[model samples]
Target chain A: MKKDKIINRRDFIQTGIRTGIGAGLGIIGFGLISRSVEGKTIWQLDPAKCVQCGNCATECVLQASAVKCIHVTDMCGYCDLCSGFFRPGALELTTGAENKLCPTGAIVRTYVEEPYFEYRIIEELCNGCGKCVQNCGAFGNGSLQLQVRQDLCVNCNQCAIARSCPAEAYSRVEPETAYLLKGFEELKITD
Target chain B: MQQSIKHIKERYIHLTTIIIGCCIFLFWLFYNPVHNFTEAVPGLDNRPPRSSSLGSEVIIGEHFTFFGNAPDPSLTGRWPNFRGADFDNIAKDNVELIDSWPATGPEIMWEKDLGEGHAGVAIYEGRVYVLDYDERKERDILRCFSLVDGTELWRRGYSVPVKRNHGMSRTIPAVDGEFVLTMGPRCHVMCCDATSGEFLWGMDLVKDQKAEEPLWYTGQCPIIDNGVAVLAIGGNALLMGIDCTTGEIVWQTPNPDSLRMSHSSVVPMTIAGKKMYVYNALGGLCGVSAEESDKGKILWTIKDFTPNVIVPSPVYVGDNRIFVTAGYGAGSALVQINKSGGSFSARTLQIYKPSEGMASEQQTPLFKDGHVFNIQTKDAGTTRNQFVCCNPDDFRNILWTSSTTERFGLGPYIIADDKFYIMNDEGELTIARFSTSTFEVLDKAQVIEGDDSWAPMAIADGRLIFRDSKKMVCVDMRANE
Candidate 1:
């Protein structure tokens, strides 16, 4: 019978070479399971579950509030008139960035040797805008605060400046040893 | 009938040549790019032979062997990623230590308490990772201790509250054997699960590559290699890689030439035989090429020795040279490289600044035996942060410094036996003894009663780990036990 039609045309050419190697291995396994699953997960931020609402400075897309303002020189009080660097009247008392009250000049003041001065806080030009922790908690001694500098805080899960914090003053923390030294027992030096 | 019309014309030419040879072998295996380069570089193409059933209780390439002598395997001591391990803070193995330590020295062996940030420590095998910053739970942990009694063991991370400027999660994780990556200062990354801490995978390399992060945010540290990982993450794709078991990007490296991720750490290097990677990009020092499927290519770039705030971590010493340093004063550069024909060039043999002596800003100098060891700072009182020991060919004239008392020293210096422990920043610890001219303190102590300990410190097997913004110690130099 013509050799059974050449063995049915050699089993239809071996089932079309095993369906072309199973459709080229299902399109390289669906392009490697869709590139493994895109960018995995690392978004972090739990500073005790953050609620400090300022929406991380208008919900950061970066206009300067990578959530800044941080100074705990042992909760600072090495004061000389540092309500986080002046601006109630600013009539004179030098160390200028325009009578600094941090609107984005980000306080710097350095001196630390003669009756102390060391202000420091350029947290990328802080826009966490608490007005230098409200003039360093009204007339210095509070040592400016508003944490969340987790290296420029991008832990963002819902923090668009803590959802526009009016004074919800953000929360969510757990960064192992989360910063909290607001005036180191009044700048310790008790002999 | 003529054999039934010649068997229906050979069954219609064997079913149209087996359906056009299965549609041209499924369109040449989906338009082949070398079959998508072994599915985008997964160990390249089947390589699983080196197991030999634990040959003689294995210990293979001897990454610093230590078993009965006790200098190498104490639950697997790890400086895990960045500068520790071959990134080059040097710690390939060998300990036996204790040339001195007894005046209240070397017997602490345990401390725990840690949580502020500067994030460094990634020991592995027996645990002891770190990332800190947990003000009550604002979150940023990743912890995991137990290098032998430091305890803790599992932490993972979240939250993110911070406030202290001189303190805040820095970035340094990348372990290997089964994953334990991490990057997060702001670049995210994550990975997890080396034994059970579990997180599995993560990404956010600066909002999916719009990438900028680094005024103090992403301190680089995330290299991996072979199993993939990479990540310098400076948009237009400065470097990506991924897929250390399915995180999956597997090849990005195309900054076109934008660069940007330099607080330092991504070094790898190989040169003449070709492996490459090297880094330090905001405007200068590159090298890429890790073996072309294209994850990175750069090869070489210099850019006038750029520095505005680079933060040390490039040291390659011997075999084409390379050394870099930075801080507010911005000084130190060596370079060299060369290659020719296939491409690579570099140049710039020495630059010096900070008054021309040693000047690093956060540990990453030590080259060893041929001499390099650094730690200078204090800008202009003629060098006060001390602890030098130069001569890498005309970065010139210092040979030795370190009478101790200089203050703010940035942590990192741990060589055992040839001595040199150092740790100052107000937590003290000294020990010195690296001769070529002088630096022989021999004993100091203070092991973290607290105060800016600056991070860096992780000996292995014979154990010594260190840390401070709160706590994380582990002394036990071995020899008396």
Candidate 2:
């Protein structure tokens, strides 16, 4: 009976060790899988497909839409009379509240050269209305585009903005390439 | 009293500590002072309202600004004015444009975005001129670019609050060695130095000339001949010749009948060795004297041969013969001007519907070797929108058609070196031959991927510049090399 009991105890101890090893390995595997899946994907705007219909500003559930205008400095023409900044047919080509195309006054234009003015966007103030983007794409070099900042985004599985987007321009992209900018294509004059 | 004082003193220390903590919390809560958001600086994101109408109160020739610096002049050949260096829409000296495009198609040297319009470009030696409208700033800009790389050289503009009327600018700039003349969509004509972007002179036709804007904005392409810019004003004057150097009005054609202007441009035609400016006005057709002796004098005016609307300029077919066409069921007419007894008399030889004969909508027919080549309008029965060649004598004699397989819609074609460089509305450029009996498309290439490749082709030094609605492209079409 003692021999049998000892045999049973040994069996139990082996089973426990096997169970412990299996659980440990399974935990490690799960940790790797979770790490690979978590925070790796982000919201992206495919600008080529984006129609700039002003939905980016209003569709998001957040009080202030996470979408903001991204200015690609290299693509910008830096015109003294920027189409994105000023309303069409402003009386004088000057910076003023009435003349500004941006509803929230997010873009800041600074003098860079004699005729060139560098435009930078303030993300917090930007409402993603896409009015400036519309004007810029229509008239200027299309440097200004709307993008979803992952830091400000809640990372919803089904984004409200994406659901309402008419162009279906939103997609889950790798964190590295979260924005697609026109005129900044690596390929020169492909079209 | 001592016990009470001792107990009160022990409680006093704890009470004092609580009071101090409360005071610190209150101070932290109310320490920061609040002020309103900074008032937007004056003239920074602040401006007055824009006027709704197009004939802008905004000053003309107010701003002559230089944008990007132009490169050193290297290209020597000149397209000069609207039709190439020569008055005829044909390239001279460079015959190499006849060769077929490479397998990969013509290499697009460069392209730039233009405001939505058919407003085309004019190439002088090394510069490209386009009158572009900035819709946002409410300005009509005269932009100059380098011929080599398409880099913007300089821009001269004036504020004009014009709204989009099916693409704002439509006229092409008339450029020469000394000056460049541009007519804005709102009937404002501007003159500037061709090389320096210097503001030379400005005139508002509505304000100064009493000229009525065309129905769909001006489609009239300006022409400069012998340093004199000839414009079919069609107001109080049927034609006006301005010395491009001084911007001075050299001569004017009287409009006794009060005929309105059409979209047709003034084409220099020589019948019986007499040079005259033939223009198809809204009411009828007139041939104005282009000679220095009697510049701008209406040599002959035909009142009966009139179309409801005329877009394309008349083509010089034979001696004393001109072919005039219009779309919208207006059909085609051949006007033969007989300069007998030192005077001119015009009579319509043949007039027929588009389906019955050779009729064109937007492009003027090419008269070469006694044959007329043009893309027949859709109303043309079997060969609708096909590049067809017909005998000028008999408009219905279709010697050869592009066939159903090779049809194009209202495109532009130019003949160079016995070959035709034809561009379809879908941006397909077909290099064909001027065959007497067949349509031979030697090579076809998609030079541009966009639609509406409608801007008339301009070739200078074997370089061809063309555009659609949005993009302007340049390609080297040198035949020899």
Candidate 3:
């Protein structure tokens, strides 16, 4: 009777130790599996495909659309009747915020020379609304277009701006080569 | 009976102790859940060493200096500069590369962890040069490595803080025979010893010209021609050519008309037997007379075809035709250049949206045998993006298209041995054998496990160098013995 009791006590101790070990392992396994799921996403953009639709302003989870306007000055006409800067059929051709086609008044116009004027864009104020792009493409040289500024882009899933683009302009670009300019060349220019 | 009672009592005491120990362990495991004491301990994170000093010992080798031996006259396969020998994305002779890669594609010989940058590789004299961001030092680096073993030979760069816009720096280095020229993320031009990696001279175009930096940063790769480093400073000054040997300002393309610099680089062209510099500036596309002392002659300007963004390098196929494309519904255009009386005029032949054909972001279209091949983005009519081929004269009809797997591709196409090598955004290296009818995918492999393998590829002495934002890889595509 005494020997039987001793053997039973030993077995009980062993079982308790085994149960504790199994529980510990279960906790560790759960932690590791959760970590693996978190390592999957790196957001990027494709410049060649981005369509400048107004959804970039509203669809983005952030307060501002990551998509902004970029200007290729080489492609600019430097015209006095600037389509990218002023609203179509504006009452007057002046540098008034209300007369600008861009809803946020992002484009700044400056006198470059006698017949030419330099137009620059303040990208942060741009909402990718395509107002300036529409005006630029229609009237003056098409120098302004909506580009998903990768730096500002959160790289969201189903990029809200891309889905809403009317021209279907948003395409996935290699983030490395994402920025597209209007008239940049690859060769050395000799003066 | 007394002895038995004593033994039972001892057994009960031992059992009680065992149960108490178990309770203590469970309490330790569950108590103070907020602390995570075990994980907070040292030697547990399993991260790579974070010491900033680790990069200092990563010795760039001894081959950075250039002694200028008239580069071998008969050297057939040297990709001497940014795009290639002529700033065109065309390889010299027909090389017979392997038509197909395995399911995962060609074997990756080696890969090294690199800092961020969009700068591509420059291969010359069996060596490879690249510009990359070094986060540890907070500076951009110009690193040269041996093409054979992927070993660093030398690196030269000063500290520049990275601005928070998707990281900084994107210009590729231009490698000529005796010099390597680089444009920093902020439009600073640095001419370095091609072999030694020593800083020769630096010029800040941003401050000198009072020009605003581009949206992302300066991306125009410095151009080296006839011992001069030519750069496009987008201010009132249109273009500037600096003497590579002495770092002196050789000539500045006068901005008498006040044209700003576009993101495009300068392209050298020979039209009607007259050499001219084809530059796309902010105001318009202008062709400056290469032989003129003034260098500011505007040959022709295409104001109507200007798109919002022009990122792709212009590809000049014949003496008379030029192709330009961009994203954002801004389509592709083919221009016909007519030269007479020592001046030229360009007329647009066709303009089609991305739905009709290929649109390029950063890579110049590959022109060969009267056919143009490029990776096109999507548009209104088409739901899919692809690699396409078409006639250069008419951008209208598509000759063929790649597989439609919803995968997007960017950057330049590389040709080797009658085959085209394309790296997609997801890091798949696809080798296609070119025929007029179709792009036959011989093989495809995921060479790197990262995003944005968009830098233009460099191949020299039978090695192919490619990169993503985080790493650069050198693959041996040569035939195995």
TM-score of each: 0.27, 0.63, 0.62
What's the lDDT for residue B405 in model 2?
94
Model 1 lDDT tens row, B53-167: 2112211111111111112243755667766667666666675677777766568777877666666677876676776667775556666666777766566675543444455
Task: Write down the worst ten-residue block by lDDT for model 1 chain A.
Answer: A40-49
TM-score (chain A only) for the predictions, listed in order = 0.27, 0.76, 0.66
Worst-scoring 10-residue span by lDDT in model 1 chain B: B59-68
What is candidate 1's lDDT per residue for A42-153, written digit by digit as tens?
2232322343344556667667656666677766755544656766444334555455566566666655533345678767667875666655653334556666665665
Interface C-alpha root-mean-square deviation, candidates in order: 23.0, 13.8, 22.2
Clashes of each: 73, 10, 41
Candidate ranking (lDDT, best to worst): 2, 3, 1
TM-score rank order: 2, 3, 1
Ordered list by DockQ, greatest first = 2, 3, 1
Residue B114 in model 1: shift from native, Å? 20
Cα lDDT tens digits for candidate 2, A14-132: 99999999999999999998897677787778877877888878888887999999998777766656778877545345666776788888998876533356799999899998888
Give the Å error, residue B390, model 3. Answer: 1.5
For residues B168-271, write the lDDT of model 3, one tens digit per residue: 55777888858998887766677887866676787666566666566456667778878888777767567777888899887776665556655577888877
On the 0 to 100 scale, the lDDT of residue B61 in model 3 is: 23
